[model samples]
Target: MESIYLPTSYRSSKNLETAGYFEKYSKMCPLTWGGSSSDNFCRILEEMALNDFSEVDLSALGASCSINKLQLPSEPDNFPIEVPARLSTKSKLDFYYPVTTEATQLNVIKCKEALEKKWIRSEFKFGSKRSLKLTITDNMSNHFRNDILPGTNFIYSILIYRPFSMSMGQKHSGEKLRFAMEIEALGTNLLSQIIDAIECVSNYGVLKEVENTKVNLKQFQNAKQEYPSQTVFIDGVFYNDTRSPDAEDYSEPVIKWAREKNIGKFTVSAMETTLLNTLTPRIGYPYVYIHQGNCEHILTFSDARLIQPNDCLVSEKYPRIVSVCRSTNVLCLICGIAPSQWLVKKCDRFPQEKVFLCTDCCNSYLYIDGKKVGDFELYPFFDEKVT
Candidate 1:
């Protein structure tokens, strides 16, 4: 794999007089590299050059030792200069994206190759070795989620879902095998680095924009244009439903309704989700799935609203939701899917209480309100009070 050469604003010296000892020096640096920001990393690296001892000689100092003291090792052999080994981060980037138009089979292969063997070496100014081995290595693999919705999978590689992700296109039901390109190195700005590398070696591009598609609820012939129990609005964007327009709703009746209508497919995109989450944050993130009827639904939070709902709470920052197992308060109790129709049953423990169940989990037997209940059988011990 050829290392993708990305244009970086910052570069470090590979030929400083102390270059030979950097490997040993890095081991002694006090800064935690993996978690530090790019600017902090560079600052720390500069500090190393200022006092080479800060990099190499301080290894003998215990964790409590002060860097200002700059203690030298009592035993020279303990700090014996060894061949410079390339330094890398213990973390690896797992690049997973649906195979969309912006990314093709050939593009995926090129990226895989670049990430597997290519090393992104740094360009040094004064060192005799112009190319310094930057923190990038070809360590990648392919994988799939233990559970993926059958229809178009709007797969994402983000650890924490970001709003910007919504602008990108999505995968259709036919698409499979999300490209999980793994790159390991000791540095930051990995996403930018990968984009640059792919651009250099291959035509594969990321974050490609597609023509926006308006959602049609008619496809889900059974569902009304009704909103969910909770309506949230942020920055002019709204989140109202759990499933796509044509897809099955979270409640059993709604799902059965859509199934009876013979709804075949549904599509949702990260772009749609980004629209909703850009302003509002929810406990559940956007996800894609294939339903029992083979219908595809792209879920952002639960569902999004193009038209503002009559009732909604507006906020500027991401709002947090406390974990509760109630359907009306959130989504489905079972899968967390958007609950269109809810099953109301008497709590086994508190006869006065009502328990809500989503469509899929309604008939499914499970423990509710501290007691076991049959599909459609109301538990006698469960409490209706959610909370």
Candidate 2:
């Protein structure tokens, strides 16, 4: 049977690269390319499709993964000629996709075909090679926490959960996906806020601004106005080096390389993500049904007994809960949907200790002293300069 294709999760992308997308160059200079920032976002995301890290100049990003220095190639391979190939390998700009069990790579083969817009060949390749032998480790759970909620799943909610979840846009249910996109779009701005937005949304961010037509909380329906989360994710870049501390020290090759990558891959990818999410349905995956009543009941995390009534430390942030989980100290979600309700009730009822109330919106309330503190938000923003 002809199989259907879902967008490959970042996990798959990482796996493909890990299996050997850009591995050949590991021997010498592992110079790879990153696209532009204007239209693309080069950050990495998790299963929820929420970004944790984006466009980092490999050198400046401070190589964190395990490293094995490459032996300078000029040491011998026909050395008398003073060749640089010993330090670098060539690669090309291509598209990636997962269809059925197969993944395909498309490179710009004809020059004229790429005349107006182009993806350069980083070094050189033989028979239409488009991938490298780079390995992508799956450290998603290590980086993303249950608290970091992305955006909502409008299409999925309506299609997959409408029958059971009550409404597509429940207050606290099924939001991570949409939230991630929204945050990625502007959250990629000013690295710190991007991080905070990520944190606010991550470990414990809120989603407001979803249109009224989506979901109308009975309580909020009568309230004045509230902000819902918007969902947007753009394409980005990955640079090869850190910018010179002294601005004047910048080199033309580096500058040009930056521009080229952005224009060719980064920009293209960003535009596509934007266009698709805005105009298309089912942005990437068909919502996978986990249960009957609510995904939040199963997908969300909550632990209440973690906080002792005597543990009175003030937290200015989400002043809604007094405590959350014990070991992780994360926020406790009673149910993914209608979560604001947790704030109004006494959640310390041991038998139901896993539940609690967040009166943050009630009056001088915040989300401190709970397990939600310091969760992973979308990380390392796009190519924007960090102050």
Candidate 3:
């Protein structure tokens, strides 16, 4: 297999000069107004300026134009024109705008101007497809400078991986990106404070269970009360969220199991006291996030950088989500259109052991005359959509 190499300047917008690309390209290309043929081009332009347009032979000048005779590079034979089939299913957010009409060109210019004046004060990188960067509005920056106390802060880009399912694990990559979020926080901020800001889809699952009469609502309410029983496994230690009185030490069992297997001793700490800057987090390394009693997610520190002048300066809005992935809904298996509300397990009627059904299908298929038809377990199914 042949690999195509892209220059660092071409791959990242950060490395490129902050000038018009066309001007740079023209300077680099010898034939484009920079070569010996420039004199002929200038003479033609001078002639056009002096002569009347109706009398000038435009066809003769067009034939003599140096730009028309310029040779351009052809595409490589092995260069892939179409994206790979495996990557076709992946979703992407497009930031590029094509100049199709004068109106559209004006709109693009206005959009850039808005970003410059209102949103981000610094140069915004527009070409990178893999990363999303956001900055505070100019008003927010001004407010922070005038009213807020000066302190050390950091911008963190976190990639949240999807919970593993049978299909998810079988895919090429075991980890599929559920969503990515960028947050701004002070270095003095507690780990627990940052964790609280992170909103998960599983949190909605507990509330969705209330819809199922088979399960007790009190159980879910109790679970919600114990929601702080979360842990973040960073480096070699586990940081447990023990703010609530009912918060359980979820790290004990895991540490015990690791010890039994002869793995190095792991220490557990209270997230409430641990500062965000105190921990050494490696970029792109997987960290374990256990929340809502065994709902696991792979959390990776995508980026960490010092706060800039353009960053959100409001202390109250610190640890706020700057960028988030679009929500995706899982449809019910039976109806195939409505969002799944119930999960049916160990049933003879359905082909699969576990099945997702909507409220209507669950009631109609699993019950008759206000009673369950078969000896099967029914639980509220919460789709992965973040409400």
Candidate 4:
């Protein structure tokens, strides 16, 4: 991708506004009294006069997440686009705003009422089939400065990926393909860039799962195309069990694609969906998820509700087959950030919702997905290594 170029001088408000991204936030902020909306920190930086700007790469200070071309042998048919978020009349606190807007937007509450009455957010599509999408954030105002005070600020970010039209560096027939011309080359905060880098490297978790799912879909479709009545052999891979004796049954298994597969390794998927992790009572071969980790050995289940932490580890007195799923070898729920007791408590507060099972040995956790299991929960039930 070519470097993004902005004018050095802030001669035109339009140039300066777009350079720092004033429009994005302004759109996000709902307008009252018929004024402009607000954008987020990314946009704010985008609008910086090229002269005032030092560097706009990733980490906003260092090398960016910019890659010339990234190739994934297996990838999703469609990756969901991130909706752009606006600074609320309340968000004025989370970031710096236009000096002029700041003075008027200072009255956060009053502005909110006005935005609620007027402003509307617009959605932008990036992919050819409109497979990927983004929506401009509605604006908000806030009152915060200096202190680590949590106010009505909504943390926002953009969903980034290999844009469909983006030029792949590998040329075909001596011709090069071009990518999106408007992708902001300027990076965000240092921590954000770090997070981005982490995501870029670690996303194998989600990518593997998504690719596996897509492969399964392709196999199923292929089966239907070749022989409608035939059972779809889902590549016969270790992680392809999916609990069903046959996969051609459901139209869409509808699994939640991993949200944190920023790295490019293995996906931390549910035991049932992974290689060598399941049983096909009538079939010749059982399903599996592990190339090595024998998660199937200690996976236990119970009709009893496995809701509480106590359920994870039973006490001797009441332990007459509780839902304890353990492992002699290490198990990890390494998906996203490790959830805390406080976060668990929050889950408890909302019983209808799912709780994360990520723990010390487990790198990540997923709770209560379809079929009574969750995403990324490992089950040690595999008998042999998957080829």
The 0-to-1 C-alpha lDDT of every candidate, in the order given, reads 0.30, 0.24, 0.59, 0.24
Query: How well does candidate 2 score on lDDT at residue 86?
Result: 45
Give the per-residue lDDT of model 2 (tens digit) for 119-209: 2243122313322222222223354333311221111111111112344656665333321111221111222222122212111212223
* Residue pair clashes in candidate 3: none
- Per-model tally of clashing residue pairs: 30, 73, 0, 80
lDDT of 4 at 123: 14
How close is every model to the real structure, measured as TM-score? 0.20, 0.16, 0.60, 0.16
Instruction: Please give the lDDT score for candidate 2.
Output: 0.24
Model 2 ranges off by over 4 Å: 1-225, 234-347, 356-387
* Per-residue lDDT over 18-117 for candidate 1, one digit per residue giving the tens place of the 0 to 100 score: 2223334444643533233666657775766743556445555434464323444552424332323563332144333334443343433344535434
Candidate 4 on 267-303: residue-level lDDT in tens?
2222232221121111112111111111111111101
For model 1, the run of ten residues with the poorest summed lDDT: 199-208
Per-residue alpha-carbon lDDT of model 3 for 80-192, expressed as tens digits? 33333343232232333333354343433444444434322221333223334443353344445432322234555566665554445465744454555555556557788
Q: Between candidates 2 and 3, name the one with more favorable lDDT.
A: 3
Please report, as a residue range, the 10-residue window in candidate 2 with the lowest summed lDDT: 152-161
